[model samples]
Target: MLLSCGQPLPLLRHTDVPPRVVENFILTGYRFPNYSLRECLLSAFRPTNETGNFWTHFLPFFIFLYYFVEVFGWEGAPHGDAQFFYPLWNYFIGVFCLLMASSMAHLLNSMSLVVREVCFFVDYGTISSYTVGSSLAYYYYIHPRAGTVETGGRNDSHMDLKPEHAGSLTSSYAILDFSVFFETFYIPSACVVAIICVLSCCNTRQRWRRHRYLIRTFVFLLPFLVSSTPIFYRLLTRSPYLSASSSFAASTSMSSFFYRHCLWLLMSAVFNISKFPERLAPGRFDIWGHSHQWFHCCTFLSILDELHMIKTEVRAILLSPTLLLPPAVLSRLPGPTVASTYGVMFLLQTTIISIIVWFSWHANSIHGPERDQLAKDHPKKPLKCH
Candidate 1:
């Protein structure tokens, strides 16, 4: 019979007892460890190999959640239309879910190879869900048509009309426009699909040979083709509702710029080949400042940058005279003022971004035993640039 000897495990000192135990003790589920209260509280917050990963992602989610609730919970606050509100809420929910999934994945992935596989799959799924949700939110509310209400012999449009339309005889018209369908849906979908497909391709060996070529082709061609959709649709339909420069159009333009400039293309190549810094440093980055984490941060920053540009364009459109219909059409709308709504949104964004930055800084500062283990594993590799 084969004999197995388990390696000696570290004992839990009173001062270094797991936070979970401390939490349980507070809940009366377990007796308190023989440690000072101050020490217990500090230890509870201190980063451990397992808890550090969870908290890193979890902190961002909590920050976002705080702002999300503040931004969306006020029933009478003036900022956005009902059409915009629901989609925005959904988008925030997706983000929350993604953050939770990421936190869980990071926490459990190192438990074992099997757990790592499961966590990775869950993380990828959450990412896909978030991408789809965000794209859908953008698509759903780009231009919403409001219903007319009869109020005291007046026709009230759902949106506020411009001041110049006060004396207009005709009822202000709000058209159900689907002018930039391609830019709103197709381009974003293409980009997201290309990203997910490439990421997935990295793992599957059986489909790798055939899917690799298909993915590459799609990633190269789809954005341009999809972006042309809005232009073609506008030309073919002669729709006045379609802006010559819509948010979707702007995002597609940025995607095109990135593609042509070879940033995404190079990143895609790097991802597919798994070469250079990643390959050379493999387990070296299994902990802090890994290439994968860098990749995630870069992808998030790029998307946010594009979305911010699109949002700025949207704000400009909202403020444009041409987009505003006549008033008498605006009196029936139930909402806060645009300025107030956007102001709250701006505040929320600022707070959340600040918190995320702080959390990231805090996470970066903590050096755990796992990091030391990684260093021991790859002592000769060049230090990773954060």
Candidate 2:
């Protein structure tokens, strides 16, 4: 079939498409299966339910790529400071992988059932990787130091300590030294959470098949919560902002950007779960303004805000020498760099997704002939145009 921006192949109604690809309340603009590869590529220019989903991330992918290259050339690779740039590189790569995977999944999933399942599985894996990317950036560049809290941004050694209270103070300090533990295991914990998220998401896709929004949301949200534990802890304790110095402005900027991103993430989650506006008026919003499109936009905004937050904090840390943790805190920090962490997560998530894809392909191979026969026998009736 000829697919183009001006004249596209005839779109299918909701009832005309297979149940697997159907979106709730989207009554029109569904594409049929087994389109040629060229047709699938051209479908991005065609008006369909998934066209927005494709372009939304596809366009943003280039935008992110530009930023990545800009950063990579400017300071990331040029400076040769792996300590500082590796986390940023990891974050950029994750965003790139996520956007490309999601856009492709939306674009070419109609080629076949197994292809669709594998595409979504890969998409979930990229999301998991992105969570780890965020965690790496947060752990390396944004986490508040334990000394910052104990000293309250001051260098006083005897300001508050008394001879009689020294022992209790030591115990209290020990109790409050949670940052050490978090800093040590934060990236590793994020990697574990990401793996679990992929498994749960793929499992939900396989098992639930339909009405799995809540389960999918819960699984994905768990990873975000876990990856952002340091951010939540910092925000709640306001540890980084306790000082009333010039750095206060820098801290405020970082916090404000963080808040904006958090809000974006919340909105994205709501859209993903609620599927509103389109749900309220099914056919009217079928070709546009769907919740998934909104989710993509919100998530893109969240990433932008997060990038700004990290950049701002990095600048602050560089300018203020005192912001660097003392020897005691640095000694407790994790040994592995962000690059190493990304390498490990990349290998693990790839292996897990490969196994899931194999399972999905195998399961579909067994059932594929029957489903094809059913489609051939019970061809859809001609749908009336609205």
Candidate 3:
């Protein structure tokens, strides 16, 4: 049967037309009969083409969520236990938001230049939020705050504070400290994001004038003012109370070092720039073992390592009371000393070793057909026509 437009109602198929053309037809307010609807729906829900994009972006969120919940529910006390949990939770949430934003941007970006521009802004916003959130989390947990005090067999109003909180009121002050810290990193990052967005969106002539102005104003100025002042003041003050050295401090420092400096920065840079393997053989590594995929793997590994460190530290703190002491040490140690010292070390080592083994095995076993498919699908010059 033919529709009102003289088009066959039962013969339409996406195979007969490019996906772009179909998208355009729909965007331009065209309608089709049963065959067209079937084709459109099939194209929209196609498993093969979009699965990688969906899973790659969303999987990180789920994985992080699981870890966050598990860690939060863990019982027992460690150094900075409450502090560690809160910041890490914020960091994970920030990362999850970033992944979601990035996924959306990548998925819809190729639809049109306008769509690309919008998505780019969204992606930048997500990244900024992530940075801010992570820094804030760190600041909150590291800084000192008010604790409860008991007097005369009852809770009293007299202020009780840790060394870190000396001359301050509570952990709430950390909010301001974090705000400044966030601004420091975020301003420059925001500028970079803005420049990228403008250059991506604007034509050559328009970019020179209009985009530059926007970049200098919104991206440069705002971030500069917000991030710089507070960071400068904090640095100048040399406040020992800002961040204390606890077991949690050691664990978080190690984790952050791996994630922020080694994993996230290094991996993201390599993937974005497509250096090394990608440069040597562009299309060859596209499908399964591309630079991007490797980057993802590295990121996951980094996060896992961080989580392990946290877990180890927590376990160590909780098990401190049960560990045995060496003969020489036990003779000099107080009753609680032996268990706490040995327990901490044992838990730390166990967590670190277990995480290392799991990741190493998983990494080794990843070679398969998926890698081959990626190479085949993503040739070096995938965008040569454009």
Candidate 4:
């Protein structure tokens, strides 16, 4: 009954469209390909399988964007030098980009085979960039070495402290500092891993479409695990129940939130790979309650928890920089290096995906619908995702 531009744009059955757009266990509610851009945009409001997927992240995109403006207006300019907040800015941008890219991909990928391929690649690239952004924030804010800065004086209240006196807090008690070797290579290695994540995921999606669910899951999980190593180390080695210092107490609180985020991440991944409840009753969940929808919800929750944890960490550092941060690290806060590195990594991954998608578009264009028909006839088995 749905209409696009006053014409009825009916949903299709599984057989009505190409196999590439068909999700396992979902038999109806597919939009036809080659829809105009207007129709594709309007599809978000229709009762299609992808409508949930689109809104899950699209709605959160606005929420995250609002928070970014809120944080920038309320926290960044009024408190101290804006340069010190680059890590937070980078993290916020990553959340924004990933959510928006994912929502748009879901809504618009049905436009054509080429658009489908390109849109998902763009999604993968944004996810990879987000991992690097998380690492950038982690390196400066969450890593154990940077966790608890010892301010020599106990002012008891962070409210009374001045930004100019941040450098004077000179205590150095951390949960545990790693070898100098690890400290030097952490950020660089994370950037490398992010690049690998994109390459491996794109390759698997292109080459192993039939059984790529697990392979793709592994590809993305590796970077998340790698990026979260610092958080894991802190959780395993330190007890949050005991508060060692004011800064340590704040770090422990951040760890608690990290633990919650990890739980949400785990739930998201499980839903993504298992294809639960929906798989138990095919076609029943074509328009709702699908595993992919749950995955989006869990991941969005995880992002929210991460934002809160970072906010707490930022507050601690700003309130008593000298007490909570080391001189070497604190001195570098005013530079653009952290955000600049994130920019470079973001650009690198996006460039690689763009190249891959370009070749894909041309190949699909050359082969045209004949190749798609052949794909449908010999349809790859075990399609695991939506």
Which regions in candidate 4 have their CA more than 4 angstroms from the true location? 1-5, 68-81, 147-182, 236-249, 323-343, 346-350, 358-386
* lDDT minimum window of 10 residues, candidate 3: 146-155
Ranking, lDDT, top scorer first: 2, 4, 1, 3
Candidate 3 per-residue C-alpha lDDT over 1-386 given as tens digits, one digit per residue, 9 for 90 to 100? 22345433232233443232232111221112112223333422333222344456667777766766675455554333333344455556557767787666545543333333445455555554454444333332322111211111211111234445443523333334443334245334433443333333232212344343234224423432342333333333332222432332433343343334344544544554443464566444433344444555555555555445445444433333222111122122222222232342234334434433443344324422333443455332312221
In order, what lDDT does every prediction score?
0.39, 0.70, 0.39, 0.68
Q: In model 4, what are the clashing residue pairs, if there are any?
A: 149-324, 150-171, 151-323, 166-322, 169-322
Candidate 2 has which clashing residue pairs, if any?
A: none
> Taking the tens digit of each residue's C-alpha lDDT, what string does model 2 give over 231-298?
66666554343244444455568778888998998898899889987988889988889999999999
Query: In terms of lDDT, which candidate is strongest?
Result: 2
Residue 27, candidate 1: Cα error in Å is 40
| Ranking of candidates on TM-score, top first | 2, 4, 3, 1
Clashes of 2: 0
lDDT of 4 by residue, 221-271 (tens): 778877887676656554221233455565557877888898998898898
lDDT of 3 at 255: 35
TM-score of each model, in listed order? 0.43, 0.81, 0.43, 0.80
Runs in model 1 deviating more than 4 A are 1-81, 110-115, 141-278, 281-286, 317-386
How accurate locally is residue 131 in candidate 3, as Cα lDDT from 0 to 100? 45
Residue 70, candidate 3: Cα error in Å is: 1.8
Top TM-score model: 2
